[model samples]
Each structure stands twice: as structure tokens, then as C-alpha cells.
Target: MISGLVQILLFQSLGELVSKFLLPTLPGPVIGLVLLVLWLVLRKGINPDLAMVADGFSQYLGLLFVPAAVGVVLFLPQLQANALAIISALVGSVILTIASSAFIARLLSKRESHE
Candidate 1:
């Protein structure tokens, strides 16, 4: 467990350095995650220790949202003031998501039929 955590932190620190020096646009953690994914893909499998650590983290993933929820609560007044715009944006995003998914599925089916 300690080893896995160390491995994760190592990647995160490496990612931070890369982000600071090379990729100014991306967040350190996201770059770290991309690096981790590439590493896993190259290895062709998840390390057992890493997998175990990830499983433990996944179980408590909901806890990660607490901060965001707190932010929403903190800005409740602003949210309420802009409720209409927020609702419209939410609805628009859902509609766009559904439309894009359908378009992609149709394109995939057409490609499969052609093949």
C-alpha cells in the first residue's frame, strides 16, 4: 500500500515538474494521470499493488466531491441569482451530449456496415 502510494505521488511530482516546465495549460494532476495511463498502456496491465490502491481509493471517491459541494453551498446566493442561466446551460449541455452520442453511434454503425 505504501509502495503504491509512493508510486502515485512520484508520478504526480513528475507530472508537476513537466507541467511547470513544458505544459503550462494542463493541470499537474491531469498530466500525471495521462502519464500514468500511458505507462499502464505500455506495460499492458495494471500492477497488482497499484490496482489494490486504486480500488481502495475508488471506494471513497464520493468523498472527493465534498469540496465541490461545499463550494456550491458557499456560492448559493450567486447560484440562485443566476439560476435561469445555469438551468439553460445544463439543459443545453444534456441535449448536446445526447445529440453527439447519437451522431457518433450512427457513424460507427455506418463504418461497420461498409466494412
Candidate 2:
């Protein structure tokens, strides 16, 4: 368990290093996740210890939203004041996201079918 945690932290540190030194504009966590994925793909096998650690984290992923939830709660008054605009933006963004995802999936499926 300890080793698994260490491995996770190691992956995170690699991501932080890449973000800080190579791509300062990118979010460290995102970069770290990509790096971890690349590492797993390249290895072509999950390390049992790391897999256990990752599973534990995944189980509690919902808890990760606590900070954002708290922020929203704290800013409720401000959000209420601009509720209409926020609702419009949220709906518009969700629609756009779904449309783009569907379009991309269709394009990928078509390409795969042709191949």
C-alpha cells in the first residue's frame, strides 16, 4: 500500500515537473494524468500495486468535487444574482459539448468503417 502511494506520488511529481519546466501554461494534474496514461500504455501492463492504489482513488473520485461544491455554496449569492446568464451559458456549453462529441464520434466511426 505504501509503495502504491509512492508510485502515485511519483507519477504526480513527473507531471508537476513537466508542467512547471516544459509547459507552464498547462495544469499540472492534467499533465500528470496524461503522463501516467502514457506510462501505463507504454508498459502495456498494470502494476498490481499501483492498480490497487488507483482503484482506491477512483472509488472516492466523487469526493474530489467537494472543493468546487464548497466554492459554489460560498458564492451562492453572486451566482444567484447572475443566475439567468449562468443558466444560459451552462445550457449552451453543454449543448455544444454534446454536439461536438457526437460529431467526432460519428467521424471516427465512419473512418473506422471505411478502413
Candidate 3:
């Protein structure tokens, strides 16, 4: 478990360094995740120990959002003031996401059928 945690941190730090030095526009953590994915793909599999550790962490993922929920509670006043805009934005994004996903899936299916 400790080793897996260390490996995760090491990759994240490496990502942060690369982002800071080479990609000013991109976020460090996001870059680190991309690097991790690339590493896993190149290796063709996940390390069993790391997979176990990740699974353990995934189980508690919901708890990790507790602070964010608390933050929303604290900001209820501000949220209420801009509720309309927020609701509209949320609805719009959901609709757009569904539409784009359907479009992409249709395109992919057409290409697959042709192949």
C-alpha cells in the first residue's frame, strides 16, 4: 500500500515538474494523469499492487467530496442569488453532452459498419 501510494505521488510530482517547466497553459495534475495513462498503456497492464491500492481509494471517493458539499452549504446565500444562471448552465451542459455523445457514437458506428 505504501509503495503504491509512493508511486502515485512520484508520478504526480513528475507531472507537476513537466507542466511547470514545459506547459504553462496546462494544469499540473491533469498532465500528471495523462502521463500516468500513457505509462499504463505503454506497459499494457496495471500493476496488481497499484490496482489494489487504487480500488481501495475508489471505495472512499464519495467521502472525498464531503468538503465540497459542505462548501456548497456554506455558500448557499451566494448560490441562491445566481440560481437561475447556474441551473441554466447545468441544463445546457447536460443536453450538449448527451447530444455530442450521441453524434460521436453514430459516427463511430457508421465507420465500424463500413470497415
Q: Number of the top candidate by TM-score?
A: 1
The sequence of per-residue lDDT tens digits that candidate 3 reaches over residues 1-115 is 7877777887889889988999978888888889888998999998987788899989999998999999999999999999999999999999999999999999999999999
Report the lDDT tens digits of candidate 1 across residue range 45-112.
98888988999999999999999999999999999999999999999999999999999999999999
> What is the alpha-carbon lDDT of model 1 when measured against the actual structure?
0.93
User: Judged by lDDT relative to the true structure, which candidate is superior, 1 or 2?
Assistant: 1
- lDDT of each residue in 1-115, candidate 2, tens digit only: 7887887788789889999999999988888889888988999988889889889999999999999999999999999999999999999999999999999999999999999
lDDT of each: 0.93, 0.91, 0.91
How far is 29's C-alpha from truth in model 1 (Å)?
Answer: 1.1
> Which stretches in model 1 have alpha-carbon errors above 4 Å?
none
Candidate 3, overall lDDT? 0.91
For all predicted structures, in order, the TM-scores are 0.86, 0.84, 0.84
- Candidate 2 regions off by >4 Å? 109-115
